[model samples]
Target: MSTLTPGEQAVMSRFDLGWPESDIAADLSISFARTRAIISTFDSNPAHDRHREAQIRRGSQRLLARLRKAGGHR
Candidate 1:
C-alpha cells in the first residue's frame, strides 16, 4: 500500500497508540472538539480499517510467537 497522508497517518497512529484526544489535538495544533471529529472520521474510514487490521494481525502473530517460545498452547 501507498504511504498515508500526514493527517491520515497522524490520526490513525495516535488513535492506534491509544492517545487521548486532547493530546492529539495539542500535538496537531487543533482544537479539542475538532480532534474529536477527526477521531470519529478515523473510526469509520476504510483506509484506516486496513491499517487497523494489519496491526491486529501483527499483534496476534507476536503473541503466538511469545506463547510458542514459552511452550504454551491454545
Candidate 2:
C-alpha cells in the first residue's frame, strides 16, 4: 500500500463520500489547483489505485450484506 499523507487521506475519504473536488478542496483548506494535483498524483500510482479500489469494493460488499440482512433489496 502506498503511504498517504493525512491530508491526502482526508481528500480520499471525502471522495468516498461523493464530494466534488472543489468541495473537498474547500473542506480541506486546499486550493482547487492543489486538489487537482493531488488527484493526478493518486491517478499516477498503480498501487494506490488498486488499494483504493479494493477498499471501495470491500466497503460496498459490507454495505450490501448489511442491507440484505435488514431485508432491503432492489
- Top candidate when judged by lDDT against the true structure: 2
lDDT of each: 0.80, 0.83
For model 1, which pairs clash? none
Model 2 lDDT, residue 74, Cα: 66
What would the per-residue lDDT of candidate 1 be over residues 1-74, giving only the tens digit for each residue? 45667876787689788899889888988788877766665576788678778988999999999999999956
As a whole number from 0 to 100, the lDDT of residue 59 in candidate 2 is: 100
Model 1 Cα shift for residue 65 (angstroms): 58
lDDT per residue as tens, model 2, 1-74: 68999988888778777799999998889999988777756655688788777988999999999999999956
Displacement of residue 69 (Cα, Å) in model 1 is 69
**Residue 48, candidate 2: alpha-carbon lDDT:** 75
What are the candidates' C-alpha RMSDs?
Answer: 10.7, 11.4
Tell me each candidate's TM-score: 0.47, 0.52
Prediction 2 global C-alpha lDDT: 0.83
Q: Please identify model 2 stretches exceeding 4 Å from their true place.
A: 43-74
